[model samples]
Target: MAGGGRLLRKAFPEHWSFLLGEIALYSLVLLILTGVWLTFFFAPEMSEVVYQGRYVPLRGIRMSRAFDSTLHISFDVRGGLLVRQMHHWAALVFVAAIGVHMLRIFFTGAFRRPRELNWVIGVTLLVIAMSEGFAGYSLPDDLLSGTGLRIAQGIMLSLPVVGTYVSMFVFGAQFPGEDIVPRLYAMHILLLPGLLIALVTVHLMLVFQLKHTQWRGPGRSNRNVVGKPLFPQFMASSTGLSFMVFGVTALLGGLAQINPVWVYGPYRPDEVSTGSQPDWYVGFLEGALRLVPPWETNVAGHTLMWNVLLPAVVLPGLLFTVLYVYPFAEQRLTGEWGGEQHLCDRPRDRPVRTGLGVAGTVFYAVLLLAGGNDIMAYSFRISLNALTWIFRIALVVAPVVAFLITRWLCRALAEAEQKRLTRGQESGEVRQTVEGGYASDHRPVTRFRPGAPRRPIGPGEHTGTASQEPSAPTRRRR
Candidate 1:
């Protein structure tokens, strides 16, 4: 206990960006709690049942037992609805926080050296959590989820020779089979979550082992980290943040009505709700599918639907593969093969890396926008075809433009910072030069060295050095 207590007293860096990871971790905890509560009431069965619940719209309607049980949980079981909604909302927040945290790590170059494995673990956790959320939502057997599942099956079935077999293996027979809900239930509550929890544990352990990477600021450096101890201050703040996450999730669960399965009704093969959409995390894939033009060719007695296979299967695989290999790729490209980095780089300091990050973000944003093209068209009263064409063009053009612009912007910002360091701020005072020309005074800037003490150690004492004059005079000649 004493040894553990000593370990608990270790220091943690004070940075707002670091909180993004904490948010993701706390949301995962909430998800587990709410999901466990929901599991007690949720039925993972596909037996046909006539709905006999308080939701009048679907009352007496014949639907899968899964839907009926979900309605039961919503209207019959006490506090079940709140817990269910909270679980869903937490899932959304979990993935989103992970994404933001990843961006923070990426831009700061926290994924360098020994910490690269942790990055891999973090990305794996994200993928698992996303899959788990999909499974959880689909267990309700609602129209929207069913549609997503069908689309998934279609994507699988588009995979050349083994497509049919893979689809059958996954569904346990055909589309809307009896075994799928139970299988997804097991995956959602057990398999995928277990994998996520394990990966998260490993990731956290790595973080603890490697300590934390901090920005280049006061009292921060590669050799030493600055901030509060974990035992009291960090622990208290983390606990408070966890509670806040729970409270906010609870609040949103009560107020925000998402995935109202009752309104969408039961899953039917032929009937689909107009403007059907998956959750935001899954939007990119939907957008890709929408963007890809239908192109099919027969070869070797198999119909290869390039559009479906390319966007849905090949694209995601390539994206994740690249993501998995990026740390090494970056290390190789920059020839920065070295030891661990405790101090993070400012995004502007690494223009190419920053530009690449911006380009990827733009690509994702474009696809996400493409996913909602129908809604945009309806909202603005524009032609759907025109909107589709616009997105298709934007999808390719935006990322390239963003890359070039971001690279230039990063370089420009770096130049500005250099100027600020060298020339300092303008004093707004005009002086008559010896050459009879007016010139604005530019004072030299004095910045304290990183890790330098900010306050005096003794009473009635002061610290820091005075600003020095610039190396070269700035007097303009007439």
Candidate 2:
């Protein structure tokens, strides 16, 4: 059994590219362990209860059991606050690692052929992770989370026909309702988690079956992997990372307090904070909302849900869908089919693919910045409408420019490579030759033909049949 375990461990790849997925897996494990601990004390119910927790400052306040329990965990339960904070922090890390990992795959052109479906699955996992975080954050029914939900509902209601139905189904009624909290709780704990787990399982299976992409270098074929095994090295590194995550969570819990529902108070209809924001993962959606023009109209007695909802829901859905289908779309465009690629350190090695990835990243960043439009406007003292228009135009124009620039850059590099192959490398300095001509003291150029006569030539010398003497004469002399 020990020998069998050793063999299995030896089969696992230990490349750094493989670590991105491991980081995500470790974060998920931390989330689950912390979540299980918190579940014992948390009350998912939204029924109003008088707050009488261990915190003397906010004693006897009127709040829901969820809020009161949160208070207890924050102040009373042994290391409860730290555990809670760790879970939240780990969640953030999990989402971030997955995003970066997907970017790495995209830039490396690893999302080709056999791994296209895995790419789709990865995008789905991201969507589910975002949903889970949103739901979990909102379960306390705090002012901040409530405001976010309201924005979300508006986005949902912006769809042309089924907006109202979707909104109603999601919220369990309009605005502040009793069922919303419990519904979010169920999704946060059960639905999203299940889906995420299943998708992750499938993703891992695909990864093992297809194998990880190793770095591209001399003698490194795409099928040949290079790295440590999963047993001692990878396992040790992952364990350390898990501990690091826990430590960071604890530090954040002790030093910085986020989502202090006690401070925000209960969810009231009239109250609004100046900078109420959703979690970082969903910030891009918020940015889109700020950038969209507030236009409204009525068609056939049904209100056009454009002003409030379109940016929030439809746009984000479309964006994620595009990400999911991008690999297949790219394959169709390029007509290049392959299995997993060997990893490459230089982004320019695969120019078009890398450029496309960069363009997509820039597009996402633009939207994310747009999400913070109000903050940007306030800081810069610019008209919000003007800011919105600028971003809206950029939303269309920036991506096109990025795509063109990236493609141009790629073509330029390819041209440079061709030139290098034909003309040879240039030395930095020019030297005067003894034969009254300028010469470069650069390394001699080496030609790579499978099997051919090798004769050294000066610059500008003919290298084909003109340069070679008749071999038949030499054979006759021999």
Candidate 3:
């Protein structure tokens, strides 16, 4: 409690949107706890073994030790399945929360100026988290996971000259090599997690050192922050949030089913379950892979598989590169490098940025949906080839349409706000005017703020020089 000149005295914004990062932090904590529990029972090996434990069906079925250990954890160990499910759910939530948090930051222009490096860190964190998730997903060595790894290997081999060497080095053999699972297990448990923890620690330190950005409103400016201090106010709220996250994950782990590796059985190179899908974070890439036309190039007696490399490699590369360069590009465009920004810009006020964000979101959504095209085609009895073509067309067209519509909507909203400042809001009461014309009364638009004093509207904020409606009485506040 004693925080004289300590981080305990730091203030945080009271906005609900600000809690997104906290959700991510808490989810990561749960992931670490549950993952550690899982590590004890999990065997990261590729050795062939007969599954003799648990249910009778899988007994004597030849499987990898990795898959065998997973079955052991699921059925042999006490509460191991629950812990595994919790770890899986926590990873999903961790990635999801970070994504939504980044969206909030992007839409609010919080990535500008002094916070640019933090934004880059955020992008890096998201990339690493996805990588960690993929590595973990592949460690089970189940049929579904092995299929994903097979696809991964295919993607790797789609590279240029070094593709063959890289693929061999990674798998340590042709395909489904002995060392893949162990290597992934090491990276998942040790390397990626350590990096995640270190990066998270640095992110929090930077957040405190840089101070929080607030909205543009009365008495809130770049020069000052308005919110509760960390010690008793923000700390209490954050602590409550962390507990809530843990409880929800625990409940989901206990109640809902996820990653049923037992039903999937062990890895078989020739077998694949139809309607199988990767986790949501990897769905976009899957969609991209499906949407790209099969195209290859002959280069110096070697083949460049554009069908595989373009969507799998180049798309992701360009996406992350754009994210890393966006803040700097915007700064250069607006000449905002002259001074640091501590106030977040309203999305409507920056139509181009808001539009770009919405467009990108739309693009991702389309790709994500495209990832399940086969499932959708069967569900609706549509032709698979037609559906694939439709998704490919939508992928190109949807983002452009979204950008235009969002830009127009932002401009319209900005204009409406300007109108409200001038003519204010309609009172809805029609009355006879002095010249025998009926008119509705207008009142100054007052924003609602619970538990805070109302901001007095300045006269200069409105000039009803061209208004046709009569002035209405000020409404009493609750």
On lDDT, who's better, 2 or 3?
3
Residue-wise C-alpha lDDT for candidate 3, range 21-45, written one tens digit per residue: 9999999999998888888889999
TM-scores for all candidates: the values are 0.93, 0.84, 0.93
All candidates' lDDT scores? 0.83, 0.74, 0.87
Residue 196, model 1, lDDT: 86
Q: Over the stretch 1-478, how does candidate 2's per-residue lDDT look in tens digits?
A: 9866743554344445667877898788888888889999888877888777776666777777777788888788999888888788888989998999988888777777677889999998998898899889888777787788787777777787897898888878777677888788788778898898999999988877676665543223555554555667656777886787667767876787777767787666687655656778998887777776777889998888575667776777788888888888887887766544544434665667776777777778888888888888899999888888888888888877887788788778767665565576566789988899997755444432225554444332323332232211000000
- In model 1, the clashing pairs are none
Lowest-sum lDDT 10-residue window in model 1: 469-478
- Per-residue error (Å), model 3, residue 386: 0.8
For candidate 2, the TM-score is 0.84
On lDDT, the candidate that comes out on top is 3
Model 3 scores worst on lDDT over the 10 consecutive residues at 469-478
For residue 324, model 3's alpha carbon misses the true position, in angstroms, by 0.3
lDDT tens digits by residue: candidate 1, 60-106: 89999899989998888998788888888999999999999999999
Ranking by lDDT: 3, 1, 2
Which residue pairs clash in candidate 2? 155-309, 287-370, 287-371
Off by over 4 Å in 3: 1-6, 427-429, 445-478
